[model samples]
Target: MIADARRAVVRAGVAIGIGMGGFVDGILFHQILQIHNMLSARIPPDTLVGAKVNMVWDGVFHAFVWGVTALGVALLWRARGGSARVPGRMFGGALLLGWGSFNLIEGVIDHHLLALHHVVERLGPSVWDWVFLVSGVALAATGWMLTRQIDS
Candidate 1:
């Protein structure tokens, strides 16, 4: 039996948050809105072949995210038989923290560093990237606050 232990199964929640957040970003911003793709800034989807390539890369990205979400689900299932009581706030906080972390890390790595993609390709490297990062920060802060009180 896995004990909730000192961490309160935060890892599970965080993983879930990360997966969900990434999906929203990828689906909403990337696909639904048709704003940007994984390699939009690099290869671009201007040509038919380019669009196909971007679509493939986008699928790859989603696959990875799906794996992340599956991991989170596994963690939660294990925690169900644990010794400690998982707090609602703790879960939520961890979730937000995970989302924020995703935005911050992804934004910095892909947008700023590697130049794999931009927050909004049409807008170029403008306030969109900063906004993405800032939103992540806000989510993280909120999660931090929520997790302060140990429900257990």
Candidate 2:
């Protein structure tokens, strides 16, 4: 049986991982690399207005990620009071799982289903999108294995 504290720690790690993943996507892909935006598919970022619109949406996405990260921080703080020990491996696995989950869900919804954006807007639904999804599944599987090992 898993301890309540362990569960709490895992949850917190996952949440923080998700938030961190989002920040990486936003900062690296959206801002630094200048690849794609939240609504780059529908609103091309060629003009000033289009760029501003995408920026606003990006801000919204960041805000949501921040909230998730804050929630994780609170959970971690709360779990610290518990007597049960949380293995470091468990926390690390949880983070990987969370990041992978984010990639899978976001890639499917934004890049495929809704067509909100792609990994590379210039490519227009190329192999890079598939690679993203595959990498996410790989990360999630590895994380799951690590967590299961620690749990057992």
Candidate 3:
């Protein structure tokens, strides 16, 4: 059985992962790539007005990501007492697990199910979407493996 402190740390790590993942998506994909936005599919960021509107939604998404990240920070702070006892690998694994989870669920919900946006919108549901999901699975699997490697 896992100790309460360890569990808390894991939770915190996952939260951090989620926030970081969201940031990556927002910064890399949404902003830098100019590929998609929070509502690119629905809004179709072809015009200045549409782009601006998507920008607003992106801001909202960032705000929510900030909140999740803050929660993770708070959780980590609470578990500081066990910092010495917990292994670094555990934390790292937790982060990957969280990040991959975010990608998997978000990819499925936003990219496939809702059609809110995709990894690359120009192609309109192309191989990039599958690649995103597969990457998520790979991340999550690696994380799980890392966690399993911890010495008992």
Model 3 spans with C-alpha error above 4 angstroms: 82-86
lDDT of 1: 0.84
Rank ordering of all candidates by TM-score, starting from the highest: 3, 2, 1
Q: What value does the lDDT take at residue 145 in candidate 3?
A: 79
- Give the CA lDDT, 0 to 100, for residue 61 in model 2: 92
Clashing pairs in 2: none
Decoy 1 TM-score against native: 0.91
- What's the lDDT for residue 128 in model 2? 86
Off by over 4 Å in 2: 82-85
Highest-scoring model, lDDT:
3
Candidate 1 lDDT over 1-152, as tens digits, reads: 12344254678888988998889989998889999999999998999999999999999989988899999989877775644456687888989988988898889998999988888898889899999989989998888777666665
Each prediction's number of clashing residue pairs: 0, 0, 0
Question: Distance from true position, residue 44, model 3, in Å?
Answer: 1.1
lDDT agreement with native, every candidate: 0.84, 0.85, 0.88
Writing each residue's lDDT as its tens digit, candidate 3 over 1-152 gives 25776688888988999899999999999999889999998999999999999999999999999999999999888887645566689889989988898899899999999999989988889899999999899888887777666555
Worst 10 residues of 3 by lDDT: 79-88
Ranking by lDDT: 3, 2, 1
Q: Kindly report which residue pairs in candidate 3 clash with one another.
A: none
TM-score of each: 0.91, 0.92, 0.93
